[model samples]
Target: MIRTLLALNGALIRGALAFVLTTQEDIEVVAEVERAEDIGTALRTQRPDVAVADVNLFGAGVLSAGGASSGPPPVLVLVDPRRPKVLGDALRARCQRLGFLGSDVAPERVVEAVRRLAHGGSVVDADLVVAALNRDNPLTAREVEVLEIAAEGWPVVEIASKLSLSSGTVRNHLCRIAGKTGARTRIEAVRIARERGWI
Candidate 1:
């Protein structure tokens, strides 16, 4: 049997998925959690073979690129195409035993993904993978830092102060960011980067 842990947010959806998985004689729901914060502990205690969770749960600082070296089990993240940013989040997690499927896929498809992952295979949406491979982030690390601060409504001087850089240097970074993002204004640059999950 494949022991699976469900880490989605809604009780209704979680319960429904649990019911569906329970009907499968070869699968079992070992645990269910609503928040990403609970995933680590659940994984430790339950020691499930596979973990299926929402893509949004893999946000910044929540799951770093190399976090799941051997401590956590394989994870199948449900992605929503409408929120492309979450797709980037999942990619950033870089969990070796990871799988991705559209959130709206039928429950049976999720079952199939779980089985595939349990057996040392991967599951991913071909279109999503293609898009991700084609459109890569071009901004450098320092520029991303400046853009992230600017996104918070900070002024050039304050941003420079925060980063310990001069105002001219900050302005230069913003200019380069705008150019790289193909935006005419800093706000537009931030919006574009944010939409693409670059920062």
Candidate 2:
């Protein structure tokens, strides 16, 4: 049997997905968790054959891009097409056998992805593939840093102090970010960056 673990926030979705998976003769859910930060520990303890996660929120994330450990176990993230930026979090995870499936993926497909992953194969959602191939990242790396800090509502002086830039320079970066993203305001720029998964 393929031991599976779940790390999704939506209770209803998690329950329904669990029910579907339980019906599959070869798959067994070993555990379920709500926090992305808890995924690594859960994996270490449970050591399931495959992990099926939901990352539609796109938060701080489950793994760092290749840091400190031998590597994390295989993780298959479920994403929503309407909010595809969560794919950014998945890419940042840097797990070896990562996979992406649409939130609305059919049960058969979910089973297939899990089985494929359990057997050391990779899976990718079509939308995630497109996002990976087409990113141009209009903002510079520092600009992305500024925008991410700004997204948390940091003021100009605070942002400048944190980055060791003058307040005027911080404002300049915001202005350029707005122009590049075609956003009329700072908040709109942040939203655009999030939609494009740049920050």
Candidate 3:
């Protein structure tokens, strides 16, 4: 059987996934963890063949992309296609052999993806693969850095001081960010950046 551990954030999805995979003849849902903090412990203890998770479970600074002990088992991260479109690459660059599926992917697809991963293979949703290829961050490095800081709800002057720039320059950056993201306001630009995983 393909030993599997679940680190999904949503309880309902976790329960449903357990039910779905348990019924499969070749897969076993070895463990399920709700809190992100518990994932490391669970992985170390359970040592599952595959760890199904959400992108947030693979948080920045928490996961290593390399195949080190600090990293997770070969992961099948379920990403929300509606948000931050290139999460697959974001995860893959950090870890080899990462599997990706859209959050709303069918049950059969989920099973197939898991089976694929267990055998030292990988899977990415076709739509997400295409989207990742076509999707490019339009913001320059400076602009993206500015927007990332802006996501913290900093004021224009504070952001300027933090980034060592003038208040007018910060305002111009915000305006440019807003225009590029088709956002009417700085808040909207931040939201868009967040959703697109740019920040």
Candidate 4:
């Protein structure tokens, strides 16, 4: 049996995880924690084979400085499907095991993900993979810089002033970016580009 540690921000998500694991004959939830501060203690006490952590726990920061310890169990992150590539890149950069799940995934899929991860396998939902790939259109350095600022809900006029470009030029660049990414709006283009590591 794969003894698992459940670390999630929401009580509902935690309860759902526990219910799913209980249904699996070869999986057991050995411990539960809600914060990064509690992770070490839980790992030490639970001695679990795998830890399933929600991406919300990490926020915008990279993994904690001493996040990975020799005695700590392997971690598999559950992340939003729309931002899988961004989360995947962060996990990969840390040399950590990861699994991506849409917020709406069923309990059976979560159990299967946990099982696969416990066995040293990586899992990313199929739809998320397609979305990541589809968002991979390359953007120029200048275009990406502009898009990053624009993504913060900035106006074209403001973006032009900040980047020392004419408003028309900013609009033109945004149009090109949207076309390349098959996005109808600048916000969608920026989100897709950022998620795919293009910006």
Best by TM-score: 3
Residue-level error in angstroms, candidate 1, position 75: 1.6
Candidate that scores best on lDDT: 1
Q: Give the Cα lDDT of each candidate.
A: 0.81, 0.78, 0.78, 0.74
- Write one digit per residue (lDDT tens) for candidate 1, span 37-98: 78777776777888888876643222332224465677888886544666766776656778
Model 4 backbone overlap count: 0
Over the stretch 1-199, how does candidate 4's per-residue lDDT look in tens digits? 9988888888887987788797889998888878877776666666777777777664322233233355445566666766656655545545466667665688788888888878888887777666666765478888888898998998999999999999999999998888888899887887677656577
Worst 10 residues of 2 by lDDT: 59-68
Per-residue lDDT tens digits for candidate 3, residues 1-199, read 8888888878999999999999999999988988777777766677688888887776432253222354556788888876745575565455676888888888889899999988988797877776666667888898998988888888888889899999999888888898899999888988887677666
For 39-131, candidate 2 gives per-residue lDDT tens digits of 766767777777777774323334532211445556788876555556765677545578898777787898899999888898998866686
Model 2 earns a TM-score of 0.73
The runs of at least 3 residues in candidate 3 whose Cα sits more than 4 Å from the true structure, single-residue gaps closed, are 59-72, 83-94
Stretch of 10 with least lDDT, candidate 3: 59-68
**Model 2 clash number:** 0
**Every model's Cα RMSD, please?**
5.0, 4.7, 3.4, 4.2
lDDT of 3: 0.78
Question: Between which residue pairs do clashes occur in model 3?
Answer: 65-94, 65-95
Error of 4 at 67 (Å): 9.1
Which whole-number lDDT from 0 to 100 does residue 117 have in model 1?
91
